[model samples]
Target: MTAASTGDLLTTPDDLFWQEHSESITESDEELLRIVGSADLPALLAALAAATADTSFLSGDLRPPLTPVDTVGHPHGGMTPLQQERGRKVAFAALKRLRDEGITRARMLSEAETDTILEYLGNGHTEWAGMLRHELDLAPDKNGAPDWRFEDVAAGRDFTALIVGSGVAGLAAAHRFRQAGVPFAIIEATDRLGGTWQKNRYPGVRLDTPTFGYTYSFAQRTDWPQQFAEGHEIREYLETVAERSGVASLIEYGSALISAEWDGDAGAWSVTTETAAGTRQVRQFNAVITATGQLDIPNIPDFPGQASFTGTAVHSQEWDERTDWQGKRVAVIGTGASAYQIVPAICAGVERMVVFQRSAPWMLPAPAYHKPMTEVFSWLSRKVPHYAQWYRLWVTVLGIPGRFHTVRAEKDWPGAPLSVSPRNQQVRDELTRILGEQFSGHPELLKHAVPDYPPGAKRMLRDNGVWAKALTSKNVTLETSPIREITPTGIVTADGTHHEVDVIVYATGFRPSEYLEGIEIKGKEGIEIHDAWDGDARAYNGVTVPGFPNFFMVYGPNVGGVVAGSLHFMLERAGEYALKAIREVLERGIKAVDVRPEALDRFVEWVDTENRQMAWGQPYVRTWYQNSRGRVSQIWPFTNVEYWEATESLDPEDYDFLA
Candidate 1:
């Protein structure tokens, strides 16, 4: 499908909205076409109000509606039918005037007008107004113009910098560096880009979050083929972002970083690299950014006798598309997110499938998880300027801060092991109801599927009834027995039951707590970063370290899988902060800037303290969020908005400047 041009509304357009999975127009497309095609104010207001209703329970719209309408991919304020009618009239008149006058930019609206519109869209609340401004790049400049572009503030000074990995975070870093006129090189271990997206090639691989929230705020897309996009589409989007941001040329593909040694005297890092051709080279840079994200490394467990019995063993991260699973017996180890997605895609083809579950993950309801984006809605976004941005803001509001209340541990709440607070209990009940409904026919399977731990204790899986359907298949078996060992033929359970399979697929997640492992990073006084971490990795604000001077980690420890917001938003802010720190060094003539040890200690303490108050810190919960030492190090304890504010500006008091 091609992108729709500025003129064409009915004809199929290209670029962002094209879905490779389906070409047929949907009912949603027809509905959206009808809404945008006509110029009738009353009808438009009705359609607009109906389209933006609070179906997702997002936007904090608790008010009773006059009538419920399908509000897929739209934002609505919480209001009674009378209030909605009044609101529709006001919003319609304002929006119509803007459209007629060609006022597309945020600068066109006065501060009061902007606030009014933001408050209206935000469900009569001022909470998300600041976030909307920052996220949409509508923050005003000194001259009252909405300008989000960072100026080259390095005072004409130039320095060499090296970025490891060309993943989402690294690409973002490269973009920031290019914008700031910094000469930099991005070294990606693999031949291609998109890091995890490029590697995980299993069928039906897609994001849990909405596509609107997943995209880079700076580079928004109008055409997302689905509410939740597949892996290839996201990768393609990133590649497009790289090209458009002028960072495509700055990337050094196939060059993997081997080591980075800081020379205190020279005030530079001697970075070593190895190519696919066995060529090793050392390059010097003023600073090194380790954007080699947490999820890059696959955590492969050594199953006993696994080497002997393996017909074909593969980690989900290292999925080989060439492997034929047609009519083959498959043993899926670990029922995590990967397994949840992988099972439904391959269950129908496999002769017999066995899913070994250590713990049943809590599968949350996501109705539109499998639904595709309609062409008409895509066309509406493209035809109307600022429409896509507004939609994205709606997504951001829904995801970023909407669920923050659920994760926080309410000390006085009645629910304990099953849930933390009343709100969390409500969520658990909803999720349990959905799971139960999915497996209502199979009572035994449903029993094994329900998790014992409290909801939000681990990573939540998005369910569209596919996982339960796959498990209930006659050819599939969900094994809850503990595996004692792997035999030559198959897996040996503690009960001495043997389940034979042709292929062993490990759906085990990544070693997220082990931040920047394998790479030797030696700082001042030969202080190794790993040694400083001492099996418990900690970084100030999850980016900077005390011992590691002139080094910044993007998508680093405690920040990757944040529950509050999209990873893209976190990484973008992180990349921006890293660039700011880099600029500070060049502008101030500082050789190195190290986060003060005290500051680092305080940050770590704060993270620990905050973690104890969250679900991830529940003593009974065993998740990837915790390290071997049982410390929660992978997730950010605070909301995304808090992290954004903290990283928005730099504080010199927190760091020690060295000449």
Candidate 2:
């Protein structure tokens, strides 16, 4: 079918993004061999079945064969050359059928049929299949705004919301609120739209998640230069979202949320914000959603004589573009995600680079981490109905099946502590194989690089072979020795070795437990939110908090699903739940809606118990996932689907409403 035959149901391939990445197209117009070669053949068949109302593929040779669960790809994705060619011709015929029938949208599958299809998609894994069924409705064209709106319940109520921090979550919050007809204002501390993407501009910085699934489902983009987009590209995408969604006009840049005082008398939050020019303003907001992300604050270790350093010192979050590393010795203080990206990016130019490691982070092998999207896939995404959704569904399935289960500690296991379960041991073995293969010649480096703890203990960094190559370079040294102090010239190890360097890049991660760090919030009982938590952050579904009426947070406490699941998807859920709660107050004409302390307690109890079963919560492994109390305060120790289900609706019984 020509592009016009499908009509506006599919976006025309004339977008600005399409034009920019046009050079990356490898396949000709008539060729779909590339598509079929890499296709999740079952999903392709399902898509065709839904589009053409043909289920014969399910009973025929194109049926999904049960295979061992693979976390990275479809279980039955692999096909022979002959099979792929035949699938390609079948797919070509299916496109023609779409034109012949003038089909716009594909029909949804029956629940029982969907279950069977889901099991097929997941290689007979039944447990996670139930969670993915709801998401089947959440495609680009289908799931945009909520069907319910504020106007439907509170027609004339002048309810306005204040969204603090114009970041990824904030942008999505603004988009959702706008779509629901809620008048809102987005306050940004910086002059720009993208929050972390704008701030963290270190070399080799890109999204660890796949670009297709990482994007907002409502405003989906078919054209991304790389499978995992770079920082600047992500920043540009956010800015584009603001402009295209018309939320740019509602943003007040250079304004930071300082404090929010809940006024019991006024029945609203008396919010305070400070601008860049030292001007502060206090305004009343019906609802205040703090979208200040988890990784905003830079955590620089207070090593001895850090001020005595003679060279340039900067945190990865506070990266200064003017500082040059070319031909100069550099010291990367911590081996985290930023360090993983920065070391390889700058090591080649540096005269000598020393990477100080508290511990080694597990790296997932991602060969296509640096590769761009192929033209054929892009064509399929645009021309084929529900292709992008199916692709995302497949990616989500691949991530879920064995992943969440393997991370949890199996009871009474008879294996090493290096892995949580037998399945986990298998995962650990594969990862170890990757590391051993990369560091084969360098035994000393391999020993230091290999993580003693199990995989998924800490967040895994996406590897493109650059980290291995950079570490093996003659100039790069992985220092496992304890750092004693910092002198006027450089850092000193406990072994009496003073390693001098020209620059000190602190890749020391963020204070994720310190939620809403700069913001001082006082709730109904005149209690500070920070003092309430006392450094251990906990929230109901990572959104609402007890005693804090009409307050919500995005990317908040214990929402850390570091193993699997997409962060953007979590952000969407959190936003939706928070909006739903806000709608309850405005619609019901209630003064406020505050989460019961018992609800928060139950959530914390569940999370803590589940965390005890996960790798991150182990006493042997310690990372930013825990706080000073040694509690897993950052990660929401549950399946991402569970969080999605919990936030699907706002329960009235969970909260107290003040009419």
Candidate 3:
């Protein structure tokens, strides 16, 4: 049940570390930092291996400190000219200490030493060391993957699990289970993995999170061309992970879970799956993990006379590549993330772009949003393993709540309805200033562009001035009017103006509030999962629920967060918790582990309280974070580390073990 520790993975073979990277650094970094290699860097790096043998090379004020709230993952810290030098200094120091007394081995960083390094990486957060050390797995050898794997002889055959959906969550579950040497099968309803990435094929579709932080902790790709990786690249990345990690072989492609019914006597669930070929198969599993994300279902509004509009109507999820966009007048509905990306992409090609805006999304200033990864940085990542992880840690600060202080609320603040706190107001002003600057040339469009809502009130879209440029174009019209109804030729606004368009692009987002929509889950006494909760979705630690023994869910209700980067971390945490719980069941020879109703209620109550203090929790704000019941079902009201700690252990008191 327990594995022995692997010692000091941070150390390297003394001379080889210096020999290989020194050559690479000299050759590659000339384009970016010329002051280094031709004169100072190569010499310093060549001598680094011998100099670092003292083990005291890690002691500092030795290198430059990291810039606070770094968006890009620079070597040591910020992207400023001075910070680059700081990064260079830090990189040199780490490489210097690769050997101790010319020996192949070195002492592991003391807790204090690790904490000092982690503090710099975590944007100076006091308590981030313990979490980041494990979560980020910054060390070269450590993957920080869940190790609560069952390796007993009966693990694969007798103790088995069923994972539905081959999305990132299912992939995480399958990968961890594979590591545990457990028998498992993933049933993906679709032919492909990557979930949203596979589905959304629209042009300009790319991840908002920086690729450094967006990638999986275990599988870090060093040579990404863009800071924000595009959709196809991400999909391919997931495909690679599935194949390379040996998870693809266990997947039943085109097989979708139809119903999972629990049997008390058998201590297993009778699961039914319908394949794309229209064949149905029944199987039994000790545990069922639903990795079908909440975002699986798309939300398309039913406007009056929508079907009669005659034009080609397409949701962002259902994008058609064959549709000729050349010289077409496209009407894009909903000014959210998809809309923001889509409008700029097709604006130049279209005769005219009519963007229908319901609410203006606050644009976060991201200058390098579309910037490509420089040759120097990409080369450095390939040469140095820790450099990539360090960079990941740097940009990863944006995705943690404490590091991103814009979401924290103050009680009875002066900002009130517009902004949550003084800090929140400050952020709003900065965002507003950026918006004003972007729209300075097109002052008329300013009225429709600037967000009236507080920062963190809804989803914040990334901007690099393209949105304003697209909107202000002669061929584009920014319409703030509420859509009245669809007509045979075009759309009619509430102002009674009929605008003609050749195509309709519904950029409306997914229905995240609706959890596990298609799948039928019948638990104890034939209680359906949906009917049991009525309209509300609640899960204990966003994993298990009462009466639904042996069932686990990723992307469960109230587990989503404002600062969840790529959502891979949260999924991993939730998946790890479920796997550990299953391990306990199989080890103890129990039927299944079900969360206690009291525990579920208590967790939900706490979540509800915390959500009330968040910007999305404000009664005035209407965001995708809320369900039909007006509850903030999407956001976990805590730091990423808090969720990690909570899910780190399987608390027996919180669950009921069925015999």
Q: Compose the digit string of candidate 1's lDDT tens values, residues 227-298.
A: 789988999998998888777777788898888899999898998999989899998998899999887788
Best by TM-score: 2
TM-score of structure candidate 1? 0.86
Better of 1 and 2 by TM-score: 2
* Model 2 Cα lDDT, one tens digit per residue, 476-562: 998988899999899999888899999999999998888888789999889999999898888999999999999999899888677
Candidate 3 residue-wise lDDT, 270-341, digit = tens: 999998888999999989999988776989998998989888889998898997778998999989999989
Global local distance difference test of model 3: 0.73
Ranking by lDDT: 2, 3, 1
What's the TM-score of every candidate structure?
A: 0.86, 0.89, 0.88
The lDDT leader among the candidates is: 2
- Worst window of 10 by summed lDDT in candidate 1: 1-10
The lDDT of each candidate is 0.72, 0.77, 0.73
Candidate 2 Cα lDDT to native? 0.77
Clashing pairs in 2: 558-636
Model 3 TM-score, 2 decimals: 0.88
